[model samples]
Target: MGAPDFEFRADLLDQSNEIVLVLDPDTGEIVYGNATAMDVLGYDEEDLLGTSITTVTGFDDVESWAEHLPQDEDADHRGENEFVRSDGERIPVEASVSRTTRDGEDYIVVLVRDITERKERESELRRQKERFEQLFETAGTIMVVLDEEGFIERINDRGSKRLGYERGELVGEHWFETVVPDDVEPEVQSIFEGITTGERGGVDGHTNYVETKDGTRRFVQWHNTPIHEGDEVVGILSSGIDITERKRNEDELERYESFVKSAKDVILSIDDDGFFSYVSPASNSVLGYDPDDLRGTSALDYVHPEEKSEAESGLRSTVDGDGDDVTREFRFQRSDGTWIWVEAICTGCRGGGSDDVGIAILRDITERKEYERELAHQRDALEVLNEVVRHDIRNQLQLVTAYAGMLEGDLEGENQEYAATIRESGQNAIEVTRTARDLAATMIADERVASISLRHAVESPLEQVRSAYSDAVFVVDGAIPDVAVAADEMLESVFRNLLQNAVQHNDKAVPRVEISATVDDVATVHVADNGPGVREDMKDDVFGAGETGLKSDSTGLGLYLVNTLVDRYGGTVHVRDNDPDGAIFDIELPLAE
Candidate 1:
């Protein structure tokens, strides 16, 4: 063995911490074995010699491992493998395998170190790293890790999503230079530097705006903690909240404060228990009381006793988020021992982390209240006058109709013609009273309008007028298709007036009138009369009260009623010269879908 010219003692190999073995290069045999190898593998020195290396590891092919052995003298063998101990226990190991020559014969030297404990440590470390990454990815708040130079080292999933970028795109980018808008970067640079360098000491509640990838910016507030290695801060770990909407609301609140500060209206907030929490500055000017006096007091204390219960219920509903914004009008006690009416728009202010239950905007309407009271008093007087006129005049007209019927039974011949005339006059007076009452009702009460057939309205009025004017003939023509008009029960009376006006103004002994209707996108009803026609200058003015034709004998109130009712019902009425010297009225009404 060439005297084994070694620097250390030959027995030192047996004393080594690692397993040392010398084997034949071509055969599956161990030429030599160390004492430590014998002790660990549960084998004697004689038993190890000529033992195949395959029995030490689970693998069946020992030649495959030998193929990886070092071929050059300068290169040292290095690898990881498994081995079996003397008791058949498998163990992991880091190994060195190489071929050498001793006594001009080829041999293999193998060095093995047990790696079971190291592998257990490595596996545990991998599990811990995976757990940390999972938490980082799943965190809701925007989190980022910044290097000492204030560049992004790692960003969590939320940070990347909020900034509108892919996961890996924001990494390695300078936080200040890229994330902040150009107009604000100069001012924020020193502040960011102070945070990173520990000069600022704290970053909690530090607000800044970040420009996103889409060029829109967001307001972000951050809380940061230094990442330390021993005593030195090498980086920073920051968590942030997106506060754009909150900042916008703050700005709006400031603007609102500025506005209501000068306005006559007051805005107030009440807690869940109905105690006033905030009151606007205008409270003093508008209510004759200071705002501070209202705070910490029950919100309904100043309201009239009649309205307090209702206001309390509204406040509770608002706090529970049970309904929409509340609104009410109530009498509020003034500083001068009197009550004034105020209109309030109350909204729920207690949901999604809000602490206040109710917020209200109030405005004084004392003048409007007084005006409404006066109008009500006047309407009562007008209603009494209308009732007296309708009752007394209609009763007097009925008496005339009864007396004319009595005269008709007691007369004969040309004297019968006189009784007939008397009866007609009495009937005319009764109808006139009815029409007068209808006109008054049109002015007093709202139109009870709905969708009605335009053609039907015209025919109904013609029947009533035909009975009143037997000398005249009323003709209704055209396809008379179904067309709807916004009208009420009095709609027929509107046409009745038009037909009476045509006949009563006629100079002809036998007056001829024609009415036609057509349907399209809108319905048009035309009523024409053969009479001394209205003057051209008075065509539009004919719709006005007291307007009459040059030959008209009496009051133009009838046409005025027709125009008023038609216009109120969202229809239009106009007059034109009829064919062959007469007056034609065109009534255009809306066509229902």
Candidate 2:
């Protein structure tokens, strides 16, 4: 039996996933094979044990495996080779061999790993290199390669001819000394130095002058890309084009052409017969059409039908240059067939090439026009309301006051009581105008709302109403909670309206009004009155926009104002039956968390 440690080592070798082999060094014959070796070779372990190493690795024979044995007796051996399987298939592998001895027998141990994936990756890399080389040489653009020292390492065929140099003449030469003209060499050298020192990045559209062999120079715009070795810039790749002629044309047209294209208002000119002659580049965004598409289209095609009064005049002016500059608003049709309100300033842009063409500069005025129209409508409505409140209502109230005063002087005893009724009716009419003014102010004032004290809202209104009607008994239960509700300062008016309506409509000799509040998830206030209550059928109608219940001189806006104010504060108000009699104004408001 093998020694205990050798047996332990043998167990480890059998369980290992690596292919293991033992060969007699002298004969180069396999003496032992591990499980992995048999599995890879597609042979039984017993068959593999006695076979020659050449039987599996067809690329080598016994002498080849032992070739290094004599030179380095105890050294490790490694090589790349192909393994031939029993099923007539070959696989690539990397093998490591070392000399070993057991029981005085010289032997070799080998371990191998499959390298198919690594070989495939290497093949793909080779093909990509070939493709890059082909494109680099054949591309029409001028190409130059510079090393970290700012020396030209390579330049393609097209670049050499452009600079009037034989191929390879400029290789190994510094860019500043050999190629760049004197006027721009200093700047070129500074950029290269900055790139080498890591102070600047790669650049594009760097225009500079380059000298030719004939002593003339051309302007070239170049884009430089830094080549990196890991994270460090080691070289630079540049592609350039000659822009000598392009720069000349740009100098002539840059000033005025740039302004015409970037103008805020879209400018278009129409030729004779009312066909579009020139449309600014801005038409792409303003009208969603390419400028060329409107070149021959008529201008009236986009005018709205209802706004065609100036259509014939505008078209004739564009064709004959007959009209002076006129500013007017019109609805022009957009590409999506929607109408856009635009104010066009049309003028006779005549005497340049086409004598019959007219120019129009259209500026968008949709928002301003809409606001002006809305304000005009509001002013008209206000004029009518002033006529009613200041003239019509005033005259009628004056007549009532005059008649009541005269009746009081002419009558005597119980007949004069009619004058008191008439005088009271005039006073009520005055109160209506005052309430109307207050309601108008409230409706128009947009105030910010927040959680405010409900107790204060009810108490302030209750005290005011008591002072107005001293004969009425106003009872505010101390049980009202010190809670907050989502509302604004207008909350007092809400309570004032409900309380005043309760006492004002009361039939009792002494009106009794009770006020109480509770706080839960919502704060609720109940203003109850001991008087005639609202019927179920008329409960909702009592809060209608024009509801005046049993009161002839009322504006019918008191209860309506109460309900509207409560609703605007995110609260609810409704009438319910009081405990024994009368109406109850129950209000619910959201409680502040």
Q: Give a tens-digit lDDT track for model 2, residues 398-422.
A: 7897889799889988879889788
- List the candidate 2 regions with Cα displacement exceeding 4 Å: 1-6, 10-19, 34-47, 60-72, 75-77, 85-89, 182-209, 219-221, 243-274, 277-593
Ten contiguous residues minimizing lDDT sum, candidate 2: 1-10
The models' CA-based lDDT, in order, is: 0.79, 0.78
- Among residues 3 or more apart in sequence or in different chains, the pairs in candidate 1 whose N, CA or C atoms overlap within 3 Å are 41-86, 56-84
Which candidate has the highest TM-score of all? 1
Which residue pairs show collisions in model 2? none
Per-prediction TM-score to the true structure, in the order listed: 0.56, 0.42
lDDT of 1 by residue, 1-593 (tens): 22223335558987788988776666646767677788878888777777877777555666865676577545578888878887888778998877777656667788888888999899999998898788778877789998888899999989999999987898999987778888778766766677667776656888889989998889998888777787667888888899999999999999977986877798888788778888888888777778998889886788899988887777677667665988777888877768888888788766667678778888898889999899778777767766866798778877877887788888888887887777777766666666666777777776567788766787777887888788899887865666676677677878888888888778887899998888777778888999888788888698787776555434577788898888887889998898787889888877654
Q: How many residue pairs clash in each candidate?
A: 2, 0
